[model samples]
Target: MSSNKITLKKIAEIAGVHRSTVDKVIHNRPGVSDAVREKILRILKEKDYQPNFIGRALRNQENRKTIAVVSSRVNSEPYLHQGIQQAVQEVGVFGYDVEYYIFDIEQIDQQIEMLYTLAHQKINGIILQALYDARIPGVVSDLAECGIPVVLLNFDHPGCTDALCYIGQDSRKAGRTAAHLAKAFLHGSGRIAVINGYYEKILNIYDRCSGFTAYLAEIAPAVEIAEIVDSSENAHDLYHAAVDLLRRQQIDCIYATSSGTEGIGKAIGELGLQDRTHIICHDLYPEILRMLREGMVWATLSQDLEKQGYLAFQYLVYYLLKGIDPPSKKILIEVDIRLKENMPET
Candidate 1:
């Protein structure tokens, strides 16, 4: 029979074995003897039989699989949401369901509580945007012990060795890239004011700042980081902080490692410092894009938030459905630098 027409029933009949026995051999499940298993395998190899995954999925619909995506409702949430939605559309037909949860970035206790809640609910797998808390490793380990796999998104914790993989941009490299741009814009000898959102709590932001400072120290020693401030990712707070900093000191540039670039732009525009002050920030929020167009911001570094979300969900689904692990422990997404000329059309 043609390979396309071959079925487990036909193979079982040819081998004179029960269909259940054939199924055991096909799925590598225990119960069949070695001799019968070898015979069924021979038939399968000779016929080039292929399992009907869609049919298997349909049959398994009574026990649907669930994947939970937990993240902070930060500036990049919309792009990440789009990616997860696309993955759901592709995987929904295969008896898979996704539950998405967004929490405030500052609420670490709430996030920890939600993790325990999902574990109690017996979620099949999880995709998480981990924070830089000491409690995370133990929580992830407990989830692994419960037979739930986790894929870390955006931020990674060094202690979470039990996680399946981490999928996000290399924040250190992005920070180094930002430093390079700052050096070029300033001719390697200017004072830059650094603004970060929750820098003490977020791992990626911390790494980005580390990289930025390290790179400048190695190559652009003349580029001085005059001040580093934490503005908590709030636009109004960021605005007030930026205004205070710019008014207090003659900053040649502003490098923001988190969201709320609008605040920095407003501070510069209102202070009439746009001609003198360069701004470098992360992500491609709508306001940032507009600022780039009007020359209120100089350059911004962006990563593929959608792709990060899509792969985190897709990898978890692959593991839950097929027992496959991601090929690498770290799946690093590329960082793209955006300027006004290269900005996407609105």
Candidate 2:
């Protein structure tokens, strides 16, 4: 049969399966038996059946182009808002509709549910800040195999082969930068406490801690880590953790590798350590900037989050509009160290 004359329904009839089953096999979606899928593929090859995906995409574009932006809760993260707004502005000019979906990273079930929703949404593409979960690899793999592209924003699943590309900071390097600052501030001999999020599940948090520890060992041999606290992204929890450490050990400096610096700062101030101990944290959030100006936080590492979101959107647009893949699978955003003297312009 001629390629143009052969339809998916005809193929399904010849194979004695439902039309949806044939579609699932053709698109590499799940639920089809391996043997039946092989048979359908062999028959398609023999009949020279080729799908007109470009034409389909053009039609879909005309109807409406949808992209989903999934990330941690935005009400608490101003930087996330900046990134999403940048993406919304750029994609809107091209007539692509953008949708924002917020998830609590601490709630693994909610994160997984939102991912499943995006999977079924049949979106043109996805910009995701995925929380670490064991089930995430399979979901991401299935999405890519089914021809849906995903661009990771800020965080990525390094072991998942299906993640098309990543646009974010090199988290490990940011950690090392924090170590350098700590070494300089303390004259290379002090007790440093490291604060992190859920390290076991979050790769970025783990990487940052590893990077900071490795560098501190290399350059500041006299300095020792007082304690490594896992705060689980909660400011109040971190405050209690910090207060506990302050009572037990002499912490000369604190390095916050993940979120919840506000609580940590509060703990330091209550203990009257803010004037003596230097605190280093990540992000340039309003609270963080306030801490910087008020001399509560000595330094911070800023990842150009808005630019990361902007690039992720541009990559999806190019792929959908011009059939072009990203130039490289790994893209690095610039990581800047912010001090009171060099704070980002408001």
Candidate 3:
């Protein structure tokens, strides 16, 4: 028989054994003799039989699984949200339901409480955008002890080593790329100011800023960072911060390590500094794209947020349904530099 048409029943007939015995051997269950198990294994190997996990899931409705996606509300970038929506739709076909538990960035207690709630709810897996809090590691450990697997999404915590894998961009490398862009824009030396997004609360933002500063120092020591301002990852706050910085100093470039590019672009436009100050920011918000087209922003870096979201969910599904682990512990998404001329048509 063809390998593609191999089945447990067919294998039982060939081996002169009952289907239940074949099932026990296939699933590594006890009660099967070693001779019979080895014979079944040999046939499986020779036939190259592959289990259809989707079919199994479809047939077993009582074994429906739930995956929890937990994150701070502030980190919901648009593309990331879209990717998660897509994952949710796809997983539903395999009898898996995804539950979202979003909390305010400041509410560490609430985030922690939600994790405890999920633990009791019998969550099979988790996709987390981890906060930079001291208490997170212990909670993640508690979940692992309960046999629930976690896949880190977007932001990662070093303490949560129990997580199956991390799926996101290499923030430091993205920062280094930003530094290269800054040097090229400024012709090797100029004053650049950095606006960080929730710097104290998120580890990735800090990593991005550190990468930018270190790379810039190594490549062009003369390109001074005039100021580094921390702002909420929103346009209004970023606008006020940008306006204050622009009024006090003559900045040649502004590198924003997070969202709120619109505010910086607005400040540069209002002060008539667009001709001199080049603005580089992260992500592709609708307003940011418009800013690029209008020449208010120079370029933006994209961390492929949609792919990050999709993979985080899909990886957990594979792990839970097929007993498959991700290919690596650290899955880094590619960073793309977007300019006005090459921005997506949408």
Q: For every model shown, what is its TM-score relative to the native structure?
A: 0.83, 0.78, 0.83
Which residue runs of candidate 3 sit more than 4 Å off their true CA positions? 1-58, 75-78
Q: Model 2 lDDT vs. the true structure?
A: 0.79
Off by over 4 Å in 2: 1-62, 74-78
Return the clash pairs for model 3, or none.
none
lDDT of model 1, residue 144: 96
Stretches of candidate 1 above 4 Å error? 1-57
- Ranking of predictions according to TM-score: 1, 3, 2
Cα RMSD (angstroms) for every candidate in the order listed = 9.5, 13.4, 9.6
The 0-to-1 C-alpha lDDT of every candidate, in the order given, reads 0.85, 0.79, 0.84
Tens-place lDDT per residue, model 3, 235-326, is: 89999999999999999999998887788888888999989987888887788889888887888999888999999888888998889999
Counting clashing residue pairs in each candidate, in order, gives 0, 0, 0
Kindly list the per-residue Cα lDDT of model 1 for residues 1-346, writing each as its tens digit.
Answer: 5677987788889999889887866654557787886687667766767535444543454677888888887777778878877887666646677788888877888988999999999589999885688999899999999999999998889888999999999999999999999999899899998899889888788888999989987889998899998877888889999999999999999999998889888888899998998789998888999989998788999888899889988998999888999989999998899999898889
Cα displacement (Å) at residue 278, model 3 = 1.9
Residue range 1-346, candidate 2, lDDT tens digits: 6788888898889899999987766554558887897687766766667635323323443576788877776222457557666656544534467787776666778876877777777588887777777777787787787677888878878766777788888999999999999999889898999988778867888999999999999999999998898876778888898899888888888998877888889998999888777689988777789899988788999887777877888887888778898998888976798999998777
Q: Rank the candidates by lDDT, best first.
A: 1, 3, 2
Better model by lDDT: candidate 1 vs candidate 2? 1
